[model samples]
Target chain A: MTTLLVVLLLAIGVYCVAVLEAWIASGRFRLMAPACSAIALLGRESIVPRKPDLLFFEMGPIVLLVAALLAAAVIPLSPDLIITDLATGALFLNAALAYVLVALIMAGWGPNGAYAMIGGWRFLGQLIAYAMLVVMPITAVAMRAESLATTDIVISQSGLWNIFYQPLGFVLFFIAAMGLAFLPPFDLPTAKGELAGGVEAEYSGVRLAVFRLGRMVLVVTLAAATVTFYLGGWQGPSLPPWLWSAIKILLVTAAMLLIGRYVPRIREAHLLAWCWKFGIPLALLNIFIVGILLVVIP
Target chain B: MITAQAIFIGFFGVAAVWFGVVVFRTFSMVRSAIALLFSQTALGAMFLTMQAEFLGVLQIMMMATEMSIMAFFMVMFMMDPGGMGKMEMTHQKRLSWIVGLASFVGAVAIAVFIDWGPVATTVAETAEQTEALGLELLGRSMLIFEMAGVTILTAMIAATSVAIPPMPSPEKTHKDKV
Candidate 1:
C-alpha cells in the first residue's frame, strides 16, 4: 500500500516537474505539453549506434529510474505516509544518488561515441567535485537531528528549520543538489550546445523518454529532499500535512527548475574549483557551527 | 524476522558469490568492474540481512561510487576495454587457482575446527546500534579511524601531484624560444 502511494506520488511529481520545466523553458503554461512531448518521444524510433554496448545502453536509463525511486522511497511525505522508514534513510538517499554518476557513465559509454564518452567523463569529474558538498551538509543535518532518518531530520526542524539554523549548510546542500540533478548551469553531462546533447544525444524513442523521465524524477526527488532537510517539511500550520509537503516540494521544484534557466551553464573547471575551494570549507564550518549550536542550545 | 533475514541473506549471499565469479569471468574491463559492483552491492544487502543497517547502507553507497570510478579508470587504461577482442581476463590462472583453493580450504578448516564463542542473545535496534557504533568510533577507535583518514588524504594528494604535468616557467619558455 505504501509502495503504491509513493510510486503514484513520484509519478505525479515527475509529471509536474516535466510541466514546470517546460513552463520555465518556454513562455507558455500549457498543462498537457509534457504528456504530448512524451508521446511524441515514444513515437520516434530508438536507433542504436553501431557497435554499442547493449547492456549498458539498455540498463542506463532503467538504473537511473530505479536509483531515483529507491531514494524517493525513504523520503516521507507526512509522519504516517513514509514508505519503509529505514534507520539509515538519509544515508540511503545519498547512496542511491551516487549511482547517478554510474548511470550517466553507462549512458555515455553505451553509445560508443566520442561525445557521449566525454560527457560521462565530465560527470565523473563533477561527482568528485560535488560529492563532498553533498555528504558534508547531510552530515551536519544528521548531527542536528541526532539520527540519519529523514523523518527525524524533518521533525528536528519543528522549532527552527536548518535553513535558518545552518544557512551555510542549506546553501551548500542546495547547490550540490542542483549539481546532482544536473540542472542547467550544472548540466555539463547533457550540455546540448557543447556535446550535442552529450549523454542524452544517443538515446531516442522510449529510451529517450525513460531517460528524461528519470531525470525529472531525479529533479523532484532532490527538490523534495531539500524541503525535507532545510525547509521544515510538512511543518506549516492551517494546511494538511500532505498538502504542506506537496506545496513545499512543488515550490522547491519550481524554484530549482526556474533558477537554472537564468544562470548560464557553468564550465566544469569553474564548477569543480568553486565547489572544492568555497563549498567544502563552508560545509565544514557549517558542521562546526551546528555542533557548537547543538551543545549550547541543548 | 529471523526467517526474513535468513531468506534475504541466502539470496544476496549467492548473488554476491555469483557476481564475484562474473567479475573474473568477463572479458570487458567495464563489465568486470560492474560485476564487482554488483558483488559488493549484494554483500551490502547481506549486511542488511544481518540487521547491520548503517554498515550495509554505507557499504552499498561507497562501493557504487568507488566501483564506477574504478570502471572509468579501467576503461581508460586497459586495452580492448569493451571486450571486443574477447581477450583473456585471467593471468597466471594456475597460481591463482591454487591460492584460491588453498584459502578456501583454510577458511573452511578454521570455521569447522574453532570452538566458536557463544552467540549474542539479544539484538540491538538499528538506531541504538548506530549510536553505539558512533560512540565506539569516537572513543576506542578514534586513533585508527583518524590514521586511516590522514593516510587516504595523503595518498590522494600524492596521486594528484603525480598525475598532473608540471607547467614550464616563463623563463624556461623564453630560453627555449631564444
Candidate 2:
C-alpha cells in the first residue's frame, strides 16, 4: 500500500511538472491545458507504419516508461517513503536509466524510415558524448559519500551539501542531466525542425503519448536524482523531508525547462566535440580534486 | 508447493532461454538486437532474484547500451533493414544443431556431476559486502585495476585514430606557388 501511494504521488508530481513545462515552453495559458491535452491524446487511434518492425516499434516507448519508473523507484521521497533501499541504489538508478538509450534506438530503428534511423543514430552519438560526463561526477559523489547507496550519500551531506564541496561536479552533472533528457540545446535526436520528431516521427495517439510521458518522467527522475545527489535530498529543517525533496525537485525542473526554452540548440558536431574535449576532462578533474580533498581533509 | 523465489527463478530462467532462441531466429538485425536485449533483461532478473542487486542492474545497463550500439552497426550494414525481404542467414543447419545439442549436453552433465563447494557460512549484510568489495578492489587489486583502465583507454585512443580517415591533404591548388 505504501509502495502504491509512492507510485501515485510520483506519477502526479511528474505529470504536473510535465504540464507546467509544456505551458511555460509554449507560453500557453489554458488553466485546463494538461487535462485537455491528455483527453485529446486518448481519443486518437495509434497508427503503426506499413513496414514497421512490429515488436520493437510497440515495445520501445513501454521500455522507456518502465526504465524511468524503475529509476525513480530507487529515489526516496522521504526517509520513510523509499520504495527499495538497495545498498547500491545510486548506481541502480544510473543502470536503469541507461535503458533509455536502448529504447531510443528501438524507436529510431523500428519505424524503418530514414528520419527515424537518423534520430536513433543521433541518440547514440548523444549517449557517447554525455555518458562519461554523467558517470564521472556520480563517481566523485560516490567517492565523497564513500558508499554507492543514495541514502548514505544524502546522510553524508547533512553537514554540508555536496554542491558546496563539489560545485564543479554539480555543474557537470546538471549539464549531463539536460543531455540525458534530450532537452533543448542537447535535443539532437528529436530535432523537430530537422528530423520532424526524429525517433517519434512515426508514433501517434497512444504511442506518441507514451513517448512524451516517458521523456517527462525522465525529466522528473533526473531532477530528483540531482536533488538526491547534490542538493541533499529530503534533507532540511522546519519542514518534513518529503516536502523538502518535492520542493527541490520542482525548482530543478523549472530551471531545466527554462534553460531548455532559452538556450539555442547546438550543432551536433560542436556539442559532441565540446562534451568529449572539455566536459569530460573537467568532470575528471572535479573527481580528482574531490578525491584529493577527501583524502587530505580527512 | 512452489515458493515465490522458486517461481520467480523458473519464470525468468525460461524467459531468458526463450528470448535467447528468438535472438538467433529473428530475421532483421534490429529485431535480433532487441531480442538479445530481452534475453539480457531476463538474465538480469535472475540475478536480482539472487539479491545481487548491483550486479543485476549493472548487467542490464551494460547490455542495454551495448545492444543499442549493436543496432547502430546493424542499421549501417544490413541490406534488409526492415526484415521485409527473406534471406538465407544460416548454413549447415543440421551439423550446427548437432553441435549445439552436444554443447548443451556437456554443460548439463558438468553441472550435474561437479561437486560444488558449500555456500558461505556467513553472508555479510549488503553494505558490509559492498565495503569488502571496495577494499578488495582498491586495497588488494588497485594496481591491476589502474593498469586495466589505462590499457582500455589506450585501446580506445588507437581505435579512434584508426576509425577516422586521415583528412585529404588540402588538394594541391594549381594557383599555389610550389
Top model number, DockQ:
1
lDDT of each candidate versus the true structure: 0.90, 0.86
- Which ten contiguous residues of candidate 2 chain A have the minimum total lDDT? A29-38
Tens digit per residue, CA lDDT, model 1, A1-298? 9789878988988888888888888989999999999989999999999999999999999989988888888889989788988999999999999988889988998999989888988998898779888899999999999999999999999999889999989889989999998999899999999999999999999999999989889988898899999999878989888889888999998888788989999999899999889888998999999999999995
On a 0 to 100 scale, what is the lDDT of residue A278 in model 2? 96
Candidate 2 residue B138 C-alpha distance from true site, Å: 2.0
Per-residue accuracy of model 2 over B56-108 as CA lDDT, tens digit each: 87788788788877777776788875577777778999999999999999999
User: What is the per-residue lDDT of model 1 for residues B1-178, given as tens digits with 9 covering 90 to 100?
Assistant: 5676678888999999999999888888888898999999999989887888899999999998899889988988998898999986568989989999999999989999998988775589999999999999899999998999999999999999999999899999999999
Interface RMSD of every candidate?
0.9, 1.2
Chain B TM-score, model 2, reads 0.84
lDDT at position A203, candidate 1: 91
